[model samples]
Target chain A: MAHDAAAGAQPDPSSGGWSREVDLPSERGASRLVMEELLEQLGHHGWEPTDIFGIHLAVEEAIVNAIVHGNKLDPAKTVRVSCAVTPQMARIEITDAGVGFDPAAVPDCTRDERLEVPSGRGVMLMRSFMTTIAYNARGNSVLLEKQRAPHAG
Target chain B: MTAHRRIDTSKVGEVTVVRFIDKKILDEASIQELGAELFGLVEQLNRKSILLNFADVEFLSSAALGKLITLDRKVKTAKGRLKMSNIRPEILEVFQITKLNKVFDIRGDEAEAIAAFQ
Candidate 1:
């Protein structure tokens, strides 16, 4: 299917850099590709390998959350991803269509008892990798940013 | 997004071998289904030793890790063991990032993992 380049669409211009929008099915597997594209774009802008991995992980976690939980994996629905790269950082936004969820409602997975339970660590991992993460007004959209590491050659 | 993939299960003697033939596992439903499958295998075999082979898997997210952790806990409660083998380099990096490599009994191959139980 043709990628939906419209949902949560926005232009991201940073210090004369380029941005692109990707529309993907709200299913599994798509997130990995999306993350790869993000990495490629960031690399084109001179991001280092370590920063590339960090950005890829953060984007994957955010987009996966949107596709699985927000859009419920409905093929009919699409998760929108837009990436903006700047000399200072890379910012990405992913939006889904399902009823919004409160991030505060998610349990802390780092606790001793919950540590071994499978799942609910995506957001935590994103926070750990990215410099900042914020929920849009609707709560179905997430904005993630990772500051370019020092020596991003 | 949470990638979807299937887990193919087979038996080798008293051991239940759960093979992850997909490249990645990221979706919520798939994670839950995987968890259910592992639980069912443990109950059906009444065996605590499981060998999760990830030879085909290239990536794994925290959600996927969660499923493995859940299975680990279930097997431990049943007095069984959970061992993983043939993890790809990229996926192994994920396990290390989460420090799961330290907690999980990871081996180089299925024979070594299964032999550990014997």
Candidate 2:
């Protein structure tokens, strides 16, 4: 509980929206269940299925980048997720306990020959799904923001 | 073993149909599990031609996308074909964004994916 920095801050449960810091272990399996719970909460707030799916996938990518690529899947290292959601938008920030990276250094997997490569597309997928995205100066943290679709109620 | 349970396979004529038993492919362990199963399909089973159905899937991590690409190459090296079918609109959007829609033989139905083999 020592690292539960988000423990003190919680969204009003009645609002149907949520804001909190969730401690994510670097292990692979536990994170998916946590991701689902977050999306389910957003779904209750009237986010469209597509919107929920997009944000969910983008969120997973960010977490994976943190847990695996950033922290090298070290179980001792934990990933921290700060998430806020409303019917109109969702913002998520993932911070890893590892060194950062340069976005420009990632190669383009969309090129004709590179399409089969096993990596390098996670960041691109994040960029595509999120309305806006950024990384911290240390490169270990990524912020992903997605706006709710205008037509979605 | 849980990852093994996540994917189910069936056959439609000469084409092998691979579908995820889970609704989401966002878990890292599942990705590694699928990777191994797909490799076995290409190397050991000698069943390289595949049609992956995404009708049951709603969400998948970018890590899953990279694994799919790796499987695509494995099947190709085995001289087999891989086609995708029944992808939900949102999942399709992810492919379109990465332009991977251009890389694999994507079809709308099992019949079309099977027909592509002929």
Candidate 3:
């Protein structure tokens, strides 16, 4: 499914920085479509395929963590996704209503003992793919940024 | 060739090849469901060795990777080996970042992966 960024998107200044909010129910598969649409938006903004895939894949992990781990798949709790797509960079912020945790406490998936654990890799991925990943003091909100190469966004 | 739900499967000698039809696997429920499907197939078919071909898959999320780990663990418990093949570099980066490359036996081609079981 192709999501046209210019179709219903608001115009912004060339310098970058226009964002839209996506409220998703705490469902297991809800993150897929949102990430797909976000990728399409970034592509429209001149992001290259490799750049798009890199960021898109990371964002997918973030949204899934927010929905599954943070919200615990509760229907009442909502995962809020904030997106900013620009030619120079893309910034996505995801926040959940559930209580947050210490990011430092996550076990290393690379370790043999923790290799089979299911929840350890998402944050690692976000931190790896995004040039910068900032979390709120409460740890419930995460801001992920990826700078596009000079050739494209 | 046999189609098993969303995943397509085929037999090459004694090895079973499971190919994912979707390019991207980011859906959490779908990933969980995939784990179940793989486990059921392994048990039903009594297949000890398997090859997971990712040639058509372009992207994957952590949840999907976790499911793969789960599937691998089950195969190990059954005294079988699960090998992955044709992982794209971009997708492989995720495995490298998570350091899951150590946990998975990733091969360059399906033939190599299939031959490993024997």
Badly placed stretches (over 4 Å) of model 3 are A1-8, A14-18, A151-153, B1-3
Model 3 chain A worst lDDT run, 10 consecutive residues: A1-10
Model 3 C-alpha lDDT per residue in residues A89-117, reported as the tens digit of each score? 79999999889978898877778888778
Please identify which of the two predictions, 1 or 2, would achieve the higher lDDT against the true structure: 2
Q: What lDDT is obtained when candidate 3 is compared to the true structure?
A: 0.80
TM-score of chain B of each: 0.86, 0.92, 0.91
Clashing pairs in 3: none
The deviation in Å at residue B58 for candidate 2 is 2.0
For model 3, how many clashes?
0
Every model: Cα RMSD to truth: 5.5, 3.0, 3.6
Against the unseen true structure, what C-alpha lDDT does each candidate score? Answer: 0.76, 0.81, 0.80
Could you give the DockQ of candidate 2? 0.75
